[model samples]
Target: MPIYDYRCLECKKRFDVFMTYAEYGNKTVVCKHCNSTKVTRKIGRIRIAKSEESRLENFSDPSSLEGLEDDPVALGKMMRKMSGELGEEMPEEFDEVVNRLEAGQSPDDIEKDMPELGDDLSTGGMGGMGGGLDEDF
Candidate 1:
């Protein structure tokens, strides 16, 4: 099945039509809101998928770690992107830590608040964050 996006000319609203390959050109699309036949197919956003090896390589690149220790916002963004690339649900603590980092909270303060964060994780040489996330992870 294919999802076709359309914009109604008369109502100026967008809608989608689901169809099989055989019924695509043979079927007529109607505006879900206005029931108008005057509609035009519109291109939609595109999403790209990468292999797991490639995603891991991107995270392993040393350049990606530049200034992340000093900049909490960038660190938070990196963490969020990593999580998204992994395409899975993260724990509540992960979300809280990322949100705090993005909100300009010092990593040291976050570490003090969340003492359960273990020291087993490695930071890949991006430490010196005032004994915060860098020291443990």
Candidate 2:
């Protein structure tokens, strides 16, 4: 048996139904709140699993990031999305930079404020994966 979500048309409330696959269409769904038979099935969000390769591939499309070099906010948004997909821990400074970008701060201004950002986040030496991305990656 599985639970299904539904909303009552008359009472405008939501409820759940439990039925076997064979009894789905054959069952009479009624609202628990008001005994309303006029209920509509509600589709919940569905999640799908994907490979890491496929996820990182999305960021490799240069066309999708057109003019990103000129827009800090857009760059920050993209970076955030990429980080989520990467599912790896990033440094606090990385978060700070992204936050600054999202705040509409120009890259030059952020860099000036955190002069060591480049040298510290350099690919050759990430704060030990705890601070930045690995060079090999």
Candidate 3:
């Protein structure tokens, strides 16, 4: 599948169309916004996918971390970028934390409001208690 950009002569609007090879030239391309058949296909810029290593390398740049600590929104943006750079999907709580930070809430405040946000389930909070699996035995 290839996406093509078209400029409508009647409405002067630009839109993208995704079509297969078989559909190309078989049907007339029309402007989606104005439904105008007087449209011309234009060359669109190609997108390049960056590798995980390259993305992580960009995240480690000193400029990327600048003002991140002082500004909660900046910190949240940085965290979002880091989450995108990672190969694996981030946990749901991760997004909630970022959203709270971006909304001008401090990490301490967020943690206090959402106690389970960073709960150390492995340590069992009070002590190094197991997952109560021993009771099943």
- Each model's lDDT: 0.76, 0.80, 0.71
**Superior by TM-score: candidate 1 or candidate 3:** 1
TM-score of 1: 0.49
Put down candidate 2 lDDT per residue, 1-137, tens digits, no spaces: 89999989998777899999999999999899999899999876444477989878988877888888799999999888887787765665677888999999998898789877766666543344434545643
List all candidate RMSDs to the true structure.
11.9, 12.4, 13.2
lDDT of 1 by residue, 11-76 (tens): 877788999999988998899999999999986534458788876777887888888889999999
Candidate 2, position 52, lDDT? 82
Decreasing lDDT order of the candidates: 2, 1, 3
Q: Over the full model, what C-alpha lDDT does candidate 1 score relative to the true structure?
A: 0.76
lDDT of 3 at 122: 29
- Clashes per candidate, residues 3 or more apart or on different chains: 0, 0, 0
- Give me the displacement of residue 61 in model 1, in angstroms: 2.9
- Per-prediction TM-score to the true structure, in the order listed: 0.49, 0.53, 0.48
Give the 10-residue window scoring lowest on summed lDDT in candidate 3: 125-134
Worst lDDT 10-window in candidate 1: 124-133
